[model samples]
Target chain A: MILIEGKDITLGYEGQGIISGLSFSVEDGDYLCIVGENGSGKSTFVKTVLGLVEPLKGTISYRGGLKKNEIGYLPQQSGIQRDFPSSVLEVVLSGCLNRRKRLFGYTADEKKKALLELERLGMNRERNASFQELSGGQQQRVLLARALMATEKLIFLDEPVTGLDPKTSSELYEIVDELNRGGITIMMVTHDIHPALNDARTILHLSQGRYFFGSKEEYFRSDLGRMFMKEAGHDHH
Target chain B: MIITEILSYPFLVRALLVGILVSVSASLLGVSLVLRRFSMIGDGLSHVGFGALGVAAFLSLPPMAVTVPVVIAAAVVLLHLSSRRKGGGDSAIALISSSALAIGVIAVSAAGVNTDLNAFLFGSILSVSRSDAVVSLLISAVTLFSYSVFYHQIYATTFDPAFATATGIKTERYTALLSLLTALVIVVGMRILGSLLISSLIIFPSAVAMKLGKSYLSVSLIAAAESLIAFVLGFVSSYVFSLPTGASIVLVHLIIFALSVCLRHSIIVFRSHREMI
Candidate 1:
């Protein structure tokens, strides 16, 4: 089943063309990694696919009975997030916002689900802790918990492991892999070409003026993927 | 006895009621404003309110009627600039704020000496009429109601706007609504703390509370409590010492902010020491 498909998509901001005529599709439970360098339109493409950014031109249709709230997103950390005053539980609860219709607060079931999501991410102990006080890895886990609360089918992660220590990022990668194995389509975007990222079953390698989206094996067979692979040096996980 | 004597005055009672209501709303809005780095927008809107008041005064029209719409518009502009920002958000506010202040001063001077001029600049809570109190009460009630109704959405927007946007929350609309509420709160609060000192209500309480409180809800409640405390203490002290009500309230906030900082330092030190043991 096609979960997300974009046809002839053009992504940009304020008349500046970032990626033009890019088309891609994701199947149910597929693990896709978007790899590119800086200015390669990777993040923009992911944001557009997630309906965060308005594509300069494209039709991104979500199919296979996916509701808006069923698609989770873990965005890149921003500077403002460093000092934002919030509780971990509150941050996670916000993920259920679209699922919420009551003006008062989250429903009992939603609150319970949010707690469960935190526990799943190993952040239940920090649920009441101040979000700003958490370490980098802990914050990411809390956000992952948040994204989990938002979706049960698909998750869009924009550099979930950036700015983390190697151990922490690897742990996060394992968790993401587990999530993918559990039948959730994962769209992970990263700038660097790392060994762990190679776990992606599909690689969408974006570069200036061109992009390649295909099976992981085919990506390695392609010249663009081979050049990137040679540059990153194939090695052990 | 002095408290009773002060409370006996219906005008003072009206001022007190209005002050408490406005403080609660202002401080609640303050938490998000300060966290989102738009604290100065409160001050900016206050200047716009002042300028609107001057224009109203010059035209011999009611001030609130003129100030509310103009300040709200200014807030939208500030938020728009901040959204598309390349670091010019602050400067845009500064430019608009200073110009509005200048316009207000000039308009007030040109309009001939009106008794409302001093009140507009530094605030004169004593002059709050029965109708003015009622209007302020309604506006404050509206602000509080809206804040509570959109509490989670506001929290989501301020904490992570991109995440909020992606989740189908109309973050831009909430951002505008936030600024709109801040504008109304400012207009209503200017009478209590004056246009010049009103922004302290929006910036100080949240700044102090965020350090001491553990969670978002705690911080909001603490900020509200702190602002209300400052307003009441400043009101009573202003009566006793013959000080300006706005200045008295600001001074109390300043003291509270300073004390909280010192207490927070000790708490941090104590916690770290215990952790080591």
Candidate 2:
């Protein structure tokens, strides 16, 4: 049931390695939350898996009949990307672009699916609203809906709740948890590690030069885990 | 009757035809360029086209043919420079634009083509030959067709290039294709809008449309319509007032852009007032 496997991957940009010798495997229906301090290359790892960046070393393979394009991805939004001129519906529908084989346009079914995903994200009312005009939480939800249109099998979310209030962040996590419960594999990199670790079956704690990849309980007992928990202040809330 | 008499002139008819066609193409592609903050690229490529036109005139060769490939080459170079370095887009554009303009000025002086230079820089719509009109029509058609066929991909890339690439779109190829098409459009369009003002045709309509339209598709359509209206009005006004055609078209776009901004502000104010009531 291994959906994706990465071994000794050294992810980086422009011939320089950011995080080296990182190995991880994502199983079908598994919720893996990647946690780390800043500059631990959490986003880099996500990009490598999504094929946006190649590993400077090692291998990444997709099993379980998963195509690279079939893996939905929600990238971390920059300020410029947030101000992109597009509507909520158009943004979501564009996710289906990778799924298409033809060059004409989105099919009726694709449009319906995009609409449905918007509704599912509780954004149907804002479907025609400009994406730039949306609040941070709403923008993340729209992006999630876009990822949904890309694939139902697996999703990779990079700090989906980076700039939201605590309440909105928890609500976003609830949606992600629901997605996991519905049999989708999730690999999310998050700064809010406590809630993520609570819902995640697997915890990946990446630090400089090394990483820990195991079940949640095993992660709690590791030295890196103790350090992280201490730094994150051991409150399981 | 006077309008019909004016339209009866072959040169004027050709100018209008080519002008409208170029406007539509420029506006459609403008949305993508402006949204991506690469609007100045059109200006840069047009300058390159101006330089190529000067070189062609110096050599007694066909200007459009030389201009098209030269602008395309410049586009490719700019694309490469921008991609190779971070925050290089504007710098690359500035470098190419200034260099091209300098080369053009020198070429015009060296070849004593000041009259031809003025026509290319400011645009003499009355000078649009039959052959030039045919080429302009064909290039405009290709630009529009390419935009139509790759509309979705362009949309994805323009909105978020990294996400588009992650979703298995060949973003680089599509971006390069867009640059080439923009180059072609600018080269052909320089005949009507002039190199100095051609980028305005690509920048103004899109900027104006974004203020009024809610989505990319709607904005593109609005931009094209705005470009057409501006072009026709500008052409007519220039004919009546005996003004420079290219500057006249750009002036019309500026007025329309101002109007769109006012209209958008008025709607917001009206909605807020109603809410207060």
Candidate 3:
């Protein structure tokens, strides 16, 4: 089923449209990676999908319209976000903030769920540690764990492995693959083309308000893919 | 020695109570401001509070009555302008903060109300009235209650605004509400801490607490405790030594911040040495 459908959307901030006349759809259990150069509206598209920025001229329909407590998300990490004074546990528990009882605090079951999510991500030992003290890879995993606390399905990750070492990135991708196997649809925005080409079933190449969305094999065979490969100095295989 | 004597006085007790109330609320709001990188907005709003005080004095109205609404109005305008700007949130805050401070100073000067600039510049904790204490208490209670109730949403919004919106949290409403609450705290705190020193009361304690505390809740609580201690000590020091209450309070808070920084560095060094061994 189509979980998210954006039709001919145009989005931007304060009347300046960044991307226009774009359309896309995502189904349940699909792992789609959006790739483009910097300033190519990759992040903007992610924001639009997340409803952070309203589309100026089109409709974005959610099949099972997202619930207030559903839809886990991992935003792009930046230096500023790293210094936020929160523990790993507290950050993860925030996923369940919407679910907490109004007058009462976080219930035992909610705390258990947060802990369980952290454990699943192999961050149980670091739950008590400050978020800033963690390494970049560890921070990303903790954020992922936090997102997981909300729901197991329809996770939107913005550049999940942007600055990590190869080993850590591979491990993180393996975790993404694991989540996908568990029936979680993942929509990730990324710049690196190689690893994603290898892992993602679908690749959506966006640029200047235009996009080429297709299966990975079809993308590699398309004219835009050929142009991208030539520009990046990769031989067409 | 002086602490006991200061505690014995009813007015001093009232000052301390007012300080505690404002400190807690400001500390809570400080977390959001620091995270958002709009810490200077506190300073700007406090200056607006000073201008409002001037207006109040001129009109023979209670300073808080005028200050609260005016500061809140200024905050709303600032929030709106920042949202509409393309220079990003912190830059927008900086732009509005400086302009507001300049206008506020001008307004105060133009009013020519014979109010001591030092009282507004530095805080005069000893002068807190019964009504000021009551207002401070009410603001603190409301701030804490609302914060606790909306803790999750606020946390999510602060940490990742985009993700928070995706999760169906109304980021705009909460952001505006936070700005409004911050304005209220600034106005209420202005009576004891004064306009010039109030922002430091909001910021320094939180910075120190963030360095020491393990969690957000712990950090906020520790900040409140530290601010309370600083307020009492500052009040006492002022009473005994005749020092400026605002400067003394700020100094105590800064001392705590310096101590926390030193402690953090020492721990890092010790950990590194242990790792090497």
For each candidate in turn, the TM-score is 0.96, 0.96, 0.90
Off by over 4 Å in 2: A18-20, A235-237, B83-87, B113-115
Question: What docking grade does candidate 1 earn?
Answer: medium
**Lowest lDDT block of 10, candidate 2 chain B:** B79-88
Residue pairs in candidate 1 whose N, alpha carbon or C atoms collide under 3 angstroms: none
| All candidates in order of TM-score, best leading | 1, 2, 3
In terms of TM-score, the best-performing candidate is 1
Tens-digit per-residue lDDT, A95-199, candidate 1: 989877787978999989989988888888998999999999999989888888888989998888878999988888888888888888898887666632456
lDDT of 2 at B104: 82
Give the runs in model 1 whose Cα sits over 4 Å from its true position.
A14-17, A195-197, A235-237
DockQ for each numbered candidate = 0.69, 0.69, 0.54
- What C-alpha root-mean-square deviation, in Å, does candidate 1 show against the real structure? 1.9
Error of 3 at A142 (Å): 1.2
In Å, residue A150's CA in model 1 sits off its true spot by: 0.6
Candidate 3 per-residue lDDT over residues A1-237, each given as its tens digit = 888888988867778787788888888888898988778888778777776667788988877665534778888886237677888888888776655565546788888988998888899999899888899889888888878877777888888787899899989888888888888888888877765666788888887766788888898888777777777778656
Clashes of each: 0, 0, 0
lDDT per residue, candidate 1, B125-199, as tens digits? 988889889999998899889988999999999888888888889988898889988999999888877789999
TM-score of 3: 0.90
Better of 1 and 2 by TM-score: 1
Q: 2 or 3, which is superior by lDDT?
A: 2
Write the residue-wise lDDT of candidate 2 on A105-193 in tens digits.
Answer: 78889999999999888999999999999998899999999999999899898888877899999998999999899999998988886
